[model samples]
Each structure stands twice: as structure tokens, then as C-alpha cells.
Target: MQGLSAWRDDRCLYCDVDLSLPTGTVMQIRGPNGAGKTTLLKHIAGLSGRRAGQVSWASTDSHDDRDTFTQQMLYLGHLPGVKSALTVAENLQALAACRGINLLTHTISQALNTVHLGGYDDMPCHQLSAGQLRRVALARLFTEPVPLWLLDEPFTAIDQAGVRELEGWLAAHSEQGGVVLLTTHHPLALNCPLQFLDLQPIVEDWH
Candidate 1:
């Protein structure tokens, strides 16, 4: 995005923000609480309304061709976004169906196993712990091989081992020519080059 800005109330949360990420790069948006880190991710994902500046994909206007952008991007918000009544496998299946991809039972099983949710497939999402629910949302990374991943606070509620596994996945994705932009407080130990964008409260000058 070029000169991208967002509003929290009537006042601007961030102003004149500019950012760009190339292929095979992992960028972490870092800041203290309410620093517009998540706002930036949502803006880039076209989830929030734009107040200022532009977002483009490969030099093409992202808003003009949202379908193309959506097809190439995978977004996971901080919230699990899973249905409480749905079983673990059913949730993943619903997610795949939304992306127009039909995953087989074996594929779903394997993805759950990868996220360490192997045996919980038949259990309702509400029956699992918070971390497990997050893992259910995370299983999408294994199923959808999109080029761009926008994750907001993806490391929340997960244990150390899950964090390590996710770190490895991020590195592998970058190495495979995928772009990852995420907001997380957890210090990432990615083997690949990891970039950071720190969002601070915009200071205006009155002369």
C-alpha cells in the first residue's frame, strides 16, 4: 500500500502509511497495543474500508479486481472464525468449500494431524480449548496453498511447540515463493529472512 491510512474513531489511528512486500518474504507488523497493526493487515486484505492511499496487486488495482486478489490470498483474523457447533473436520471443510476447493476426508485428517489436532476431528470446536480452536483455523495454511497470507495475531493462545511449528511453516512458505504478512507479539525464529514494520502513533507537526 502507498500512503495508506485508517481511522479508529473520528481521529486517524495511522496516517500516510506506506508498505510493500515482495515474493518469498515474511513481514511481521509489530507495535504496542492499539498501534494499528491489525488495522494495517485488515486494510491490506481489503477487509476494512480505506480512508486514504492505495493498495495494488502486482501493479494492478486490488479494489478493481477483488476476485483475482481473493483467489490468490488467504486471510486469518485473530478470532478463530469457526462455528462453535461444527466439528473440527466440518469447520475445515466449510473453509475449503468457501475457497471453492473440495478437500477429501484424508486431506482433512492429514491437515488436522499436522496442526496436532489429529484425534479431535470428530469433536465439536466448542469442546476444544482456545489454542486448539486456533489450530483448527491454522489448519487452512496446510490446505490452501495461496501465495499471500495475511494473519492477525496468529500466535495467540498457542503453546511453545505450536509456535515453533508455525515458525517453520512460515519459513517454508517464504522459501517456496510465498508472501506472509502477519501481526504477532511472539518473537519469530524463522530460518528465512524476516522483515518487520513497526507501527507507531503518527505524529503531526504544526508549524
Candidate 2:
């Protein structure tokens, strides 16, 4: 994003940040509570509509970049966005359907297995543990491949093993020339360079 900024309610949470990130970049968003790390990522993900300054993706012209950006990006917000009424398999299938992806039964099974929820496909989401629900949401990471990833508080409710596995998945995505932007309180263990931007009212510039 070039000169990307956003405001929440009337408070400017994100300042103008002229970023020229290349492929294979892994960026970490940092700040204290209510510092706008989530707001900043939301703006980049096109979730925050009221944004200031110009933002562009790659070499695309600003006037005609929305569709291109949407096609290339995948965003996972703080909430797992799972449906409590639906079973684990149904939730994944629903997400895939929304993204215009057709996931075979076997593919979904593998994704559940990868997240260590191998036998929970038929279980209702609300019946699963918080960590299990999070894993079900994270199954999208394996369901499809996109160029950009925007994840907020991805480590929430995940255990040590899951955290390590998530870091590995993110690292692998970066290694494949995908750009990943994530917000987390815990430290990351990715093999790629960890670019950080600490959001503070006094600190407006991108680090």
C-alpha cells in the first residue's frame, strides 16, 4: 500500500504509510491496545471503507485496482467468522463457496486433519473448543492459494504446537512469493524477514 491511512470513529488510528512491499514479504503490525493495528490492516484488506491517502497494489493503476486487489487478497479478521449453527465441514464448505472455490470432500478432510481437527468435521462449531473453532477457521489457509494474506490476531486461542505450525504455514507462503501481513502479540518464528510497523500516535511513519 502506498500512503495508506485509516480512521476509527473520529480518531486517526493509522497514519500515512508509504509502503512498497515486494513479493515474499512478511510484515508484522505492532502497537498497544486500541493503537489501530487492526484498523490499519482492515484498510489494507479493503474492509475499512473510510480511508485517507492513496493505496495501490503492485503496478496496478489506482483507478482500476479494486477487482485486481480483491482477487489477490484473502483476509482473516480477529473473529474466526465461523457459524455456530453449522458443523465444522459445513463452515469450511460455506467459506469455499463464498470464495468461488469448490473444495472436494477429501480436500476439506485434509485441511481439518492439518489443523489437528481430523475427527471433528461433523461436530457443530459451538460444540468445539475455542481453539478447535480457530483451527476450523484457519483451514482456509490450506483450501486455496492467493498472493496476499491479511491476518489479525492469528495466534489467538492456538496452542504452542498450533502456533508453530501456523508460523511454518506463513513462512511457506512467503517463500512462495506471497505477501503476508499479520498482527500478533506473541513473537513469530518465521524463516523470512519480519518487517514490523509499530503503530503509535506519536510515531506516524512506517518503520
Candidate with top lDDT is: 1
150-201: candidate 2 lDDT, tens digit per residue: 9999999999999999999999988999999889998888887889887876
lDDT of each: 0.89, 0.84
Measured against the true structure, the TM-scores of the candidates, in listed sequence, are: 0.94, 0.91
- The residue pairs that clash in candidate 1, if any, are none
Query: Candidate 2 lDDT (Cα, whole model)?
Result: 0.84
Could you tell me which residue pairs clash in candidate 2?
none
Question: What is the per-residue lDDT of model 1 for residues 1-207, given as tens digits with 9 covering 90 to 100?
Answer: 799899876657788888888999899988888788888888888887647778888888787898888888999999999999999998989988998989898998889899998888789988999999999999999887799999998999999998999999999999999999999878889999999998887655657
The candidate scoring highest on TM-score is 1
- The regions of model 2 sitting more than 4 angstroms off are 61-63, 202-207
- In model 1, the worst 10-residue window by lDDT is 198-207
